[model samples]
Target: MDLHARLKTYLQNNPEAVGKVVDYNAGTDRLFPLDLTAANTELTTAIIADTQAFSNWVSDKLRANNCRYGIGGYMEHRTIYAVSSHFDTEDEPRRLHLGIDIWSDAGTPVYAPLAGKVHSFQDNNNQGDYGPAIILQHDLNGLALYSLYGHLSRQSLDGLSVGMSVHKNQQIATLGNNQENGQWPPHLHFQLMFDMEGNYGDYPGVCKYSEKEKYRKNIPDPGLLLGF
Candidate 1:
């Protein structure tokens, strides 16, 4: 089987952690899918101007929707990337996002969806970085898969070691605010990776528009795991 099939098979085979992620239960939580692309000009214009505005916009959306979280942007070509030089390069410019972003208030607790040992973590402090992030390595039927939790509060990494074990639904971290979480609205950037490509502490959560096919295979739709 190809990597996508293998991942889907493994995840389906072990279906315990589907709703265990942050406030994304299909039945209970009022979750709304957010659009952050250029086509969402009203929202983009309101948020892209500044981080505070971004935070306010997120809060307003959540409140108006009566939702605990606004989640979307998997492989989404977002205009919000312009706020940071981290995505800007002389080359293709990383606009294609590769993960599902769960927009919520700062300090919202993030739970580990599956049991695994911490593979790696670091404070990727930059304009558009992960901030304090954690990655876990899970072996499901001998399939080595990884889950990355990004834009976490600094305290999340406290006493956290590379080899520490995290159980399913474990409270691993909380959402970081704008100042520390790469200057965007407070949210959790959750991603799945079949392979890390020899990178540590961080992986490409966003890629260039031209490399969609290559990444599409490597990064499956997170909705498969989030269960909503």
Candidate 2:
């Protein structure tokens, strides 16, 4: 079977394997979708270029909405990525977000949605990078899947080794501060991938806009697991 077929089977056979990814364990809070895409003129003017101001803007928005978290940007074309050379190119830029981000304050603990072993972990210390990232490999009735937790605190990577066991709902890492999480507002850049594409410690949570169709196939809607 192909990647999509396998994904469908995985979701069908193991509907309850995954659990909460962030502080919202119920997965049914007052979650709002944020627009960091090029279309938001207010955002363009509000954030400016200050990282603290950007973080403040996110926190203020969540507070104003009475929401604990703001979600969205899966396969979204965002302009905020311009802060880093990693996402830039002389030609077409890589503004297409391939992951679902859960925006919350720094030091917020991140949990494992399912029992799995660490596939890899690394501190990708670069501008607009994952900073500290961990990928966990899991098998549900013989279907192999991987979950990526990105933008973690620097201490999260300490003492972690490949193949370390992590159980469901286990506190694996905390949301990194700006300095550790690649100079962006704090959030978990969570992604589910059928294949690693031979990458380690990191995967393309954001991709080139032209390749959106290709990435969407292997990367299923994370809501299937998050449930909200």
Candidate 3:
């Protein structure tokens, strides 16, 4: 099915799964505007200065509480230059982020948003990669779709099987830290995939700027399901 059709199908089938929200990159009110331009000036001083330490501190807090809080906003901009070089294909520049990153602490409890079976998972261990991950298949009102939870702790997949059953809000896994997870700050990379296209335990979370149209057609905005 087409991207829009797949989204409509998911919404129509799984009303309960919709409207659940998670924030991205939460922090105290003191860190408002996290303006990039202003931050550039201070970049020369230290690598682990304010911004780096701040992300680290936030990760620790979120992981300890097993919760996340940030502005649950959508990707308003189309041309994202982030993580482009990570891909092997020359089209990396066209790739866009197909997921909504819930920037929270490591070890936070990641619950199943809806009842589903464990479709697949993997430990995509690499820099800027999804560490241990889980993909759940939800069949709501006969509309089948998948949700991916990335950057999870290794223990999260301890007893998981391909067809393992997971109920809504069930504690499935905890957020992972950079040590075991992909070598990056702590965060949950949540994405929705309509067609697996024969890929398992790994999929394209990032795409190039030039391939936005094609990806947008294949991967709908995740906020449609996350409800933010």
- Each prediction's Cα lDDT score? 0.85, 0.86, 0.64
lDDT of 1 by residue, 1-228 (tens): 987898888778768654377756567789878888878877865457688987888899889999989889888998778777888989778999999999998999998888889999999998888988999888777778889999999888899898899898889999998888877789999999888899899999999999999988878787787776
Clashing pairs in 1: none
Q: Poorest 10 consecutive residues of model 1 by lDDT? A: 17-26
| Candidate 2 residue pairs in backbone clash | none
The per-residue C-alpha lDDT of model 2 at residue 104 equals 91
Tell me the lDDT of model 3 at 215: 61
Alpha-carbon shift of residue 99 in model 3 (angstroms): 0.6
Which candidate do you rate higher for lDDT, 2 or 3?
Answer: 2
Off by over 4 Å in 3: 1-6, 9-14, 17-54, 57-68, 71-85, 88-95
- Expressed as tens digits, the lDDT of each residue in 1-228 for candidate 3 is 755786687677658665343332334321111112223453232332334564665545545555544322233332322432455564444234567776666776777777889999999887667889999888766666788888889988798899999887688888887777775556677887767778788777776657667666656667676543
TM-score winner among the candidates? 1
Query: Backbone clashes per model, in order?
Result: 0, 0, 15
Model 1 stretches with alpha carbons more than 4 Å out: 17-19, 44-46
TM-score of each: 0.94, 0.93, 0.73
lDDT, residue 37, candidate 2: 82
Determine which window of 10 residues in candidate 3 has minimal summed lDDT.
29-38
